[model samples]
Target: MSDVASQAGRVIDAGAIRAGTSNAPGKTAWRIAWGVALVVFVMLWLFGKPVAGWAFDVPRAWRIPVQRWISDAMKWLVDDASFGLFSFTDLTRFLATLVEVPYRLVLGLLSTGIMDGRGSSAQEILPPLSWLAVIGVVALMGYFAGGRRLAFIVGGCFVFLAVFGQWDSAMVTLASILIAVPIGVVGGLLLGLAAFRWRAVDIALRPLLDLMQTVPVFAYLVPILFLFGFGPTSAIVATIVYALPPMTRISLLALKGVPDEVHELGRMTGCSRRQMTWRILVPSAMPGLMIGVNQVIMLSLNMVIIASMIGAGGLGFDVLAALRRLDIGAGFEAGLAIVALAIALDRLSQAFAARRPEHVAAGAGEKNLLARHPYTVAGLALIVAGGLAGLVAAPLQSYPEALQISTGTLGSDLVSWININFFDQLEAVKNALLLNVLIPVKRFLTSLPWVGVTGLLALAGLRLGGWRLALLVSVLSCLIAFTGQWEKAMITVYLCGISVVIASLVGIPIGVLAAGRERLWKFVELVVDTLQTLPSFVYLMPAVMLFRVGDFTAMIAVVAYAVAPAIRYTAYGLRRVDPQLVEAGVVAGATPWQLLTKIRLKLALPEILLGVNQTVMLALSMLVITALVGTRDLGQEVYIALTKADTGRGLVAGLSVAFIAIIADRLISAGANRIRARLGLPEGEGGHR
Candidate 1:
């Protein structure tokens, strides 16, 4: 812990110290700040509660009136806004029809085997493949993309969803996702290309991306609800909004990653700019673009629950219903389906992204068209088989009744048994942890004056990057404070703060162990993969059961949701340390602990810092979700605003979360930069963009 703190302190200002002499202003400011921190620490140790709640908090009078004004303004806009022949609502309905064109068409094909559902009549012009055929097709694609192992995984996923009585819901969810992903990809791609072609466009898009990524999803739900109204249209729209940024940003990154030499080569060939971008740049960036696609899919999956809240029906709706009814077992079953679906989609997309041309050629010569296009051939064969089978057997026309299963009952019973048998012990553990750790921390942070809180942030920024960052942080801190949301924002910060602390402590040691052993590393990789892909809502189910609801529950959810990166980065950093250094340590007769602490960890500290930065961002992103657990924080504020459909309140609260995340991101990034600089590593690319 002491080592972690020292490393963090050094990282933030390592460059600052080097950038100036001992007597420089930056050095002087850092010294003064250190002295102040020490004094405050002593004061807290002595005075405790008296020192905790010193109040320079933003006043309520300043906040509530502005909220009312903004709310009234939004209401007026909604009421007064009109077009030549239609109102905003009418326009939304027209757009909704546009969105639903492909959605309903996909639905008809998947559910009823209709090809052209776009017109008045549905025609079974296409082969209506049954569940067996769909599973076979997916398995065949997986086999082609990865291998037999992937085939089994893909086939098993379809079987699991069908057998668990989610075949219809699964299809619905998949169709919606298919509809949203393409729109998000295309929209994001165009935006990214625009940004790539123009520096001004990139600069304009940067902060918007940050805002979209950082804002709690719930915060935007209300306005979106009003605009798009309810059902799949709104849900798909919401998903597109949330998922677009990463794709766009990655597009920019992929384009930027294309080497300058490649650009020069294109120029030497006399390729026009448009030709170069379309033929050379886009194709060259396929690998990165695929990665961006992977992220879009993940983001789309994450939005399933949020989408469900607004009337998009599918597995997510079932989970949300269960959660509302406090049916942990039911929620768990549906949530598990989500997890399975996510893994399947993630694996297939990842396999495709990572697939090399040689991997296909490895099967047979390129002249063997069957080998080159195995998946396509297999898919066509399945469609033929499925159509024939469906004609022969009615049961084959849809998911077979004999194969379906329902685990909802079993889950409920299991949860009931556990609650009866282990309730006391669970309660005891929760109580002890809350009393000893989480409560005190929350109290102290919520009680702290806004001035002091901002001051500390400014101090850290100042130490890291002198006056520029200090001013930026000061302004960010004031943004929340000036909004009259200081206390709630601080509470949100405290929750994230403590959750990150717990995550780091738990994750770092495990990472060290994993890094030292390959078997452990592989096992940890599986765990990390599962955890990262697990929908953020799944953690809430267990948290609710354990802590019931409130700050403690919210804290636990945040910790679970955010811990993967800490472990991943620690192991990654340690493994990346120069192998020669470890060999030298071995020759010096250094113990395993000595080798780790003195060599690997020391060298890997920068990456570990980056992991912490990610943890904070992830934790902050959970604020609105955590609010559902009933915590009195910015998340709760957003949640309340969401339920009431108060756009102004939700927007303000959302901004508060974004600003906090931005501040933390800025400071940690600056520190990581300092660490990289001191280590004489070349600066990383794709940072500003």
Candidate 2:
């Protein structure tokens, strides 16, 4: 108890809390600050821009000359860095070779015959595992993890893969993920364990993880490409970087949340560090570790499309090819394969996370075979059935030629149908929104004098979180302006801002609807999980079909990717609202509407605000990818810089995006804190936020 209390004091800044009666004074101060900000904004709106005339933009002579330096530095590090004793280039090559061994091994098993040429070549690496054999194995494993229903769902996914002739592509993708998930999990656990053992390490890692999560994945892809020289190695390494953060975060949280009593008991028993961790700490943290693995799987799969760009051959490549050719049928088929893989893996991991260990003693087992080895019996039964099916007919043995189906034409046909029947209507709606809403918002944000905008943001930050936040937002805003990327940065911000509003407007209401109903929540979660696990690139396909190639299409893609977290966080917050307060409202003769408004939503505000914060972060992360669909934002600059291998330009644009995310994150976090303070809630009542 004493240890926990001490730790809590250090974790939360008491001076900043203000979660008490003094909140009245804090609220009054905030109101006055807002009033002043409003007046200043009005004055700027009337006369400032006319006088300045885009003078807020840093002159070319004054703009910082950092890009060239960055580019030169990166080139030296990648192509020439050495200590006279050890060459960085050689070391990276060695690592790539090490990664490629397992890559070949997994790819060989799933897509090629093993040792076809005794390691001389990778041609003919495809295996001959019949469809029935694979299906039986999956169904049996699914049954073991969840139950009959899950088995059916998983089995159906395979059937879809085979029927759609996506089996090869799907399995190749799964093979890489099979390798990446373990690497991420192990790496994350080690880092997390180190953080847990040392307080300084934890503090240092916190900001690193935050920045890493915000850095656009596209920003780092080119550097990784240079290091690993493209292929499965580069793709896998990039994925490791992308997926590792969540594991470390989840593991750290689990370590911190470990019961204090467990530690005390370990001490009393004179348990060694290794023993305690292996036998107690890890066992106790199984649920969190399992969740981390689950996330790793989903993230690895999500990287499929990005990985494909670098020659990590899989369904992602097929999807990209289809998209390039505007072959919706082909793209949709490959995308479905990805979706199937994600859902199956997510469900299996989820069920396994909830699995309970059997408690029976070795000598106390039941005599009946079924009771003694239910899972084993089921596995054996599946093998026997698969054998019989394989012998009965070739069609039943593998994805038979006769049974294979293609959606090659369906995509084009659907596109044609939409273009003919719905394109005109959607174009009208799209044009109206572009002309009246999106374009105006972009212009307004871009026209704001950078100097004035900086002041307003700093003022807001000061009102919310004092000097630290003021300095943070001010520095970030100035960096963008001084880099001469202010115009592009504003457009990025405009996209994120609009996306957040739309996401909140749609997500929060759906969340509210699902919060009170278990079945509905489950259904919502299923759809959300599917969307959340897809690569950001996948979203552009549908958006392009609906809105065509433009900034508006990119905005739609951003919203699609960012909205899932909003819905999830809102529902979670509403559900976590104090039941006792709800009961009190009911006892006070409150109606359902009154109960929700006065009790539930009132207390859920902080969580909703945090959700909005996450939505903004996600929107920012998608900017670079959305540029693929055509958008003149910072992402476009990053994309162009990367393609041209201009390290300085890419890194600058990337950092600008990161800066936006951080400012938005901190500001929203401050708003959440203020809300919590006003409501007199503890700084830590937020559950799983």
RMSD of each: 5.3, 5.7
Q: Stretches of candidate 2 above 4 Å error?
A: 1-32, 41-55, 118-128, 357-398, 517-523, 578-583, 586-593, 687-689
Worst 10 residues of 2 by lDDT: 4-13
Instruction: Note the Cα lDDT for every prediction shown.
Output: 0.81, 0.82
100-153, model 2: which lDDT tens digit per residue? 889878776555646656555644534445567677778888888889999999
Taking all chains together, each candidate's TM-score versus the true structure is 0.87, 0.87
TM-score of the candidate numbered 1?
A: 0.87
The whole-model C-alpha lDDT of candidate 1 against the native structure comes to 0.81
lDDT of 1 at 643: 82
Candidate 1 regions exceeding 4 Å error are 1-29, 36-55, 60-73, 82-87, 112-129, 356-378, 408-410, 683-689
**Model 2 misses residue 478 by how many Å?**
2.6
lDDT of 2 at 635: 93
